[model samples]
Target: MSYVITQTCCNDASCVAVCPVNCIHPSPDEPEFATAEMLHIDPKTCIDCGACADACPVEAILPDDKLDPSQMRFAEINAAWYEDHPAPEGWKPLVPTPAPPRDRGTLRVAIVGAGPAACYAAQELLERSEVEVEMFDRLPTPFGLVRAGVAPDHPGTKAVTESFEWSFRREEFALHLATEVGRDITHAELLEHHHAVIYATGASSDRRLGVAGEDLPGSHAATEFVAWYNGHPDYADRTFDLSGERAVIVGNGNVALDVARILTMDVDELARTDIADHALTALRKSNIREVVLLGRRGPAQAAYSNPEFLALGDLTGVDVVVDDADLELDPVSARAVEEDAATALRVRLASEYAGRPVRPGHRRIVFRYLAAPSELLGDDHVTGVR
Candidate 1:
């Protein structure tokens, strides 16, 4: 049995560092690293050390002996990739280089918001000579939406924040918690104190779904749902109604998939993670099973990646259904979409569900296209959405 690298692998390459046998292909420095869908472990070369499994952020790596039935396909996929191209003889595993010693200088930079962008920018600046970085956030916690917006179970994506914590401890970078730019410290004030002020504040508002009944009790934006489950302090008190047997999501982006996963995932599975206490309790009572992901355009134009779509399909006890009619390619766009990786994923999704009817107790994801939502029909409490 060989270790299998599954869908949640985000190309972070943490596993590549720990693998003693160097069985994991496409290390971050490799040419194929960017294009590879996910990391693959060479079955024949693998010594089954299990170090890759420990380093995996999303628990995407599975030991040969512990392979779940759904994950067994990954072993074949991993081994097949290597069959075509053999490993180089006398290959030495690539290792990450240590950073040079920090330069001692006094340039003050103020970063607004603690999201990925801000944290990354700060890390870059701190690498320079004598830079003093001051990071501010409206929330009391420092890591921004990585802690507040990402789904709790998406530990892989969430692990990106670890780099931020390392930057914060550099002594030159100071974190100002619970500091709002406009309310607590004006932009002018920040400018006065720092040589350069970087506004890393991400988009705070959601694009409103203009259809009628969007304000109904059952209606929710993916942002709110994601934030609520991820333990955003602002949305800690908010609640969602997942009592309906079916749900309709307005977008086909990654956020839509995140919401669908949270909604359809077994309550017990989600409860074991760091998901918010309130959100977990609500999920336990959730009756929702089917989620119809309504895309305004064809599958070829979908905004999400193929891996996310594949992960949705591989989820246990959940059946993701696509609409074949919507996936029908226009002659002009077909050739272009077939070559694009992201679009190709959409094409595959369409091909997978050519003529399947949605069944009860299954989490169905409908990829609808060409139809703009004119209105959402529901009164007082949303009874039936149109």
Candidate 2:
């Protein structure tokens, strides 16, 4: 009855902290967690206590016998990790950290931004029985990126906010929504009210490529597109030129993959999710059939994780395209691919995509390695990328 972590694993490591037997591998403390697509359970060591299943915010953990046919492979996938790196001997469960002595009065903590980080910080502070928490955010709603950055089609990932529910309901916790720290209230005011102020606000800005024509009307950042589709109030009215037959994304990271997937996604499939009505309406009329992702590095150094790249292959009516020549790795990268398990998997997946035969009617997500966008070719709006 050992549990298996499945495809919806969000990599938040919520399960890792709760497992009493320490069966979850590549934990947040482990070096591999940085690149691990998902956490896996060690079948031999798991006591089947069900703590991980209960702690999983996405409901991605389940008993082996209960797995649906499509998920049965994950059971084998869980065990295979042990073949290469066996579990350490005499592993003990994690012990809870002892709370600090409460010598003073109630420990009041003001957390800025009600995102996942803020919620987790509140959780830690609330553990001290004498602590009180106040969370502030500019938006009336909370959960920051989870609410505004995660793609709607993946509802499983969004379910993480459900875990944040208890943090809001705690009697010791108070929320101040629709209030900006710098404008509505000052940081000095917050400091006066609370003993300590924790700024859990995440990054909202997109980095510039500093290339020519990147500021054209048709050019936009991936963050803008993510917010627009997720119905973030800041970008609700944002629009993309999907009338074009092809769109070129300038990065190969997960967010770039997400943008490509959204561009080529079937309108009917996207309609089933909580996609913004405006974006959905626009998508219904979209003509985009190919999204060519540009990466300055070779396939071995592609920024996307394996799970996301693999999931792209499973998208209906979409083709994952990779040119064969772009896969040729230089000697340095070739050695890295051979020596690094993660790099090997990335190259192997790219090879698989390149080997696939194209389906004419399906939309394409073409991978272009060793390429950079020097200029956005257009008069005012983006017409082509150079």
Tell me each candidate's TM-score: 0.76, 0.94
| Model 1: per-residue Cα lDDT over 133-241, one tens digit each | 9999888887777787777767767777765667978888888888898899998998898989999888888899787887878777777888889888888899777
Q: List runs of model 2 lying over 4 Å from the truth.
A: 47-49, 64-77
RMSD of 2: 1.9
Q: How far off is model 1, as Cα RMSD?
A: 4.7
lDDT value for model 2: 0.87
**Predicted candidate 2 versus true structure: per-residue lDDT over 266-383, tens digit per residue:** 9899999999999999999999999999999999988987667877888899999998998888999999987776577789889999999999899999999999988888887888
Model 1: worst 10 consecutive residues (lDDT sum):
96-105
Give me the overall lDDT of model 1.
0.76
lDDT (C-alpha) at residue 232 in model 2: 93
The TM-score that candidate 2 achieves is 0.94
Best by lDDT: 2
